[model samples]
Target: MNDIRVDIDPALLTHHVERLGELGELPGGGMARLQYDSSWAEAQDLVATWMREAGLRVRRDAVGNVFGRLPGTDDSRTILTGSHIDTVPEGGKYDGALGVLAGLAALRALAARDERPQISLEVVSLCEEESSRFQANFFGSRAMLGLVGQEEPRTLKDADGVTMAEAMVAVGLDPAAVATAKRDDVAAFVELHIEQGKVLESAGVDVGVVEVITGLIWEQVVVTGRQDHAGGTPMDDRLDAVQAAAEITAEITRHVAGADGAGRVTFGRWDVRPGWPSIVPGEVVLSMDLRHTDPADLRKRATEAREIAAAVAARRGVEVTFERLKDETPTRMDPWLRQALADAAAVCGATSMGLPSGAGHDSQLMGEHVPAAMLFVPSVEGRSHCKEEFTRPEDCVRGATVLATALHRLAY
Candidate 1:
């Protein structure tokens, strides 16, 4: 076995995680550091301070994406790595933040290597990604890729009616200057993130080389039924929207379940109108999340799912509508970069496997505009998006060490 490794300062990395974890920590557990919020602002400033300490040029863009740059001798093009800084509501600590910290640690390690890279290297802390606060998912990455619409800032809103533009202004960012956030110099992007699934843990692998991000189909299914007094109407004479919606959702689950591991679906959000003790619900809406790795298969599955929903509603004497919320195609990682990451893992004495990411990530958007790849560390028990989510500290350090070695290989 041949191995050449790069070591990261564990103490320094642990300090970074611990200090930042405290900023948006909930009283009970987990984190909620949404973009442009006070906790988020504090965390961003703290990371920038650490970047300066690492001898990198630190700057926040128009939309609040923070970058720590180590300029190359040529300085014309750049290689970028890192993850978002924002967290999902009640999200675990490791998801996106680990990637940023790992990149920061890697850059710091490289800074001490006595030779600068041939191309500029940067570690980015993207501003908004989770969509936990606003409907503007991948806001930072989209801005960087020059994909943001002129009305996005003014139209995207949070639960509190706060427009993305208003939130930008609140953070001292001029929303009108968002166009300036676009960049054409990023040549390649790599993200190191927790797998957030059971793949690596079940396979007993140290890391995963992501093959592709799964394509997703999101829709709102609204079932309409006649409202009637629950106590006064005969059971056979009443049309219950909630009951019809429930049957449709159950059928969707069964359909995806029959696809084995090739497909998945979730009805995560629901609303029954005029919730009351004696009145049957007249309308119910269900938010549907669908996924598959193959584009054709995903489309076929989504179409079948819609048909199933309509059939279920018809059988229950109700009207249904399918409103598309999002439809994203699968993003394949750069093959060259995937191989590079695999080789880097071997160099660090860690086993690697090829896998697909089930969850959407900023890389899915970034890969559309630039060469992008991702690496995954194991998540304990496949837990994520909750307080119980965790990755072992040793695994964290090992993954970051592999990332540092990879950065050295690409940059040096």
Candidate 2:
């Protein structure tokens, strides 16, 4: 296992990346291949074609997860690799796409070897992770883990008021059979991705072995107040919901910022009812996204956030309520698998280090069900989730080689 190594073609990786990056490119700038959209479907079909060219059998599950399989001598259990295929609205090219490409490249290299593995190897292009089009985050991984709610397909709607079920049907997928996507044969899983931060690049490292993934809490805060004409309502008499909401968000941000830089809070979305300059807003709806590496600290911050909102609302004479949209605890990677990835990096002559992932991923959900781990390459200038996001080509090839080497150790 220590001696295991696999060569990845740099040109092949570059070519696939350029082709995939072109699918959902937006007119203004970045890409947006939202889940089940036309561009997303086209990208999946292209990946399936690449899988077939790489000498693997390809199939799509009921939830639209595309898998490419290389059968082994003993096929009862499988080793799974790859990541989600979906991207955020106007998202960069490498975020989710690179992991899928790395897995494909790894499988391609392994296929040319003389000896077959003792367990099946499979790569998946998960249907959704960004939740850019719908609010169902990790929908693909949840289906595989048997965590998706039965009514989600009919209930979850996109920005355009289209239900997930309708979108699935449009893509020729039967939402009624979502349960069929569950799999119990996966023995282990590994995902290779870009760091999406400056951790590795700042340290001048070649790759990163993810030690843990941060916990996240998403809450929707809604404030209600009296509506009146902006000109007639006195500043002191007006119970402005937007003002209260803004204060609440500002207080939360201050608290998180004052703490060690490890904790993060964001008010990414907000809406003011009767959005007019001449109207005193009667209702305000805002999103609070909180994250921390420590589970206890994460919970503490969430509690503090709620308390702060309630206090501010009381003082401001407005009614505030919170709805918990999502809550995910911190996830630790499998130690043995982390060591394996580090060893693989060493074998591939790439420097490696351990770090925690601040962003959410399909791996966080998958790790709870299987022995899972992640490998991360550098993102130049720590830029991600935007058009300026980039990773050097050599770093990309090195990461793929490390992934292939790790797969060789586990599968063979």
Candidate 3:
């Protein structure tokens, strides 16, 4: 292990977390920092100010990805770090915020060094990853990878029926120039994030070196059935859309439950048209989220899920249609970067373990375009995505220190 150590300030890290957490805070506790919203815009501006305070050149991309760059003696390539800034509805503070702050602290410490690195380092506050406002998941990363379609901004709409292009204009971003956000200089990406699960906490490990991120499939299922009054339609003659949708979701759940603990499925969102209590529902829309680590297994399960839905719809005499919202293959972390992170944890006197991430992250998409790895700090009680989510100050600093150590090893 190298004898290099970066002095990560626990107080500073905690302070940043607390300050950022207050941006989109709700009346009860959690936040809703959706992309292009006012709260999100404020958070991005604050991060830019902090990046400037860290002595890094700051810039925002056409899609609103905020970057803080530290130049190197050899600036031909850059080592990228950080995470998304947007949050799921009612999300807790630490999920995506910690990674961006940790990267900021790491780069700040490295900037005070006497010697410069061969490669530049940048900390990015990715504009959107949670897809809370629109159906565009990984919008920031996709912009960098040049994967976002030209029509997306004009077509994708939010709950208020505002298009993504109008939202971009509201935030002073040019939807027409989104193609310019793509970069060819990033050589590697390292994101520091909370484990968001109990694997590390249960094993008493301080940090986790993520090996792979599970593949995911998002399907929007819409069921159509005859609308009839509850008094007029007999139970035997009624074609109930809600009944069919519920049955399909239940069957899909049972199938995943039997997949030996490696599969996951959730029917999280539901919408019923003509939602009167007495009405036999005319239409119902629901979301299906399926996940597995193996690509072929994921594909097989997705196909099975579709078949099950079809069978249920046919049996119930309701017409069903499915729209694929998102389909991402399993992504493996770069081997060398994973080892470097483990070694860095060892050097910092923190126990490390290799684990697969059950939750999807921006790294899953970033890994497909550049060499990418993730460092995970333990989340208390494995809680995440809720108001109770938390990580200790020491563990937060330890993870940041390890991130700094790894960057030193890779860039220096």
Model 3 per-residue lDDT tens digits across residues 124-184: 9999998889999899999999999988899999999999999999999999999999998
lDDT of each residue in 274-389, candidate 1, tens digit only: 88888999999889989998999899888888899788877889999999978888999999889888999989889999999999888898898899999999999999999888
* Candidate numbers sorted by lDDT from highest down: 3, 2, 1
Cα deviation of 160, candidate 2, in Å: 1.8
lDDT of 2: 0.93
lDDT of each: 0.89, 0.93, 0.93
After superposition, the stretches of candidate 1 with alpha carbons farther than 4 Å from their true spots are 1-4
Predicted structure 2, TM vs. truth: 0.98
Q: Over the full model, what C-alpha lDDT does candidate 3 score relative to the true structure?
A: 0.93
Worst 10 residues of 3 by lDDT: 1-10
Candidate 2 local lDDT, residue 342: 95
Candidate 2 C-alpha lDDT tens digits along 158-225: 98999999999999999899988888999998999999999998899999999999999999989998
Q: Estimate each model's TM-score.
A: 0.97, 0.98, 0.97
Looking at model 2, how many pairs of residues clash? 0
Error of 2 at 124 (Å): 0.5
Least accurate stretch of 10 residues (summed lDDT) in model 2?
Answer: 1-10
**For each candidate, how many residue pairs have backbone atoms clashing (under 3 Å)?**
0, 0, 0
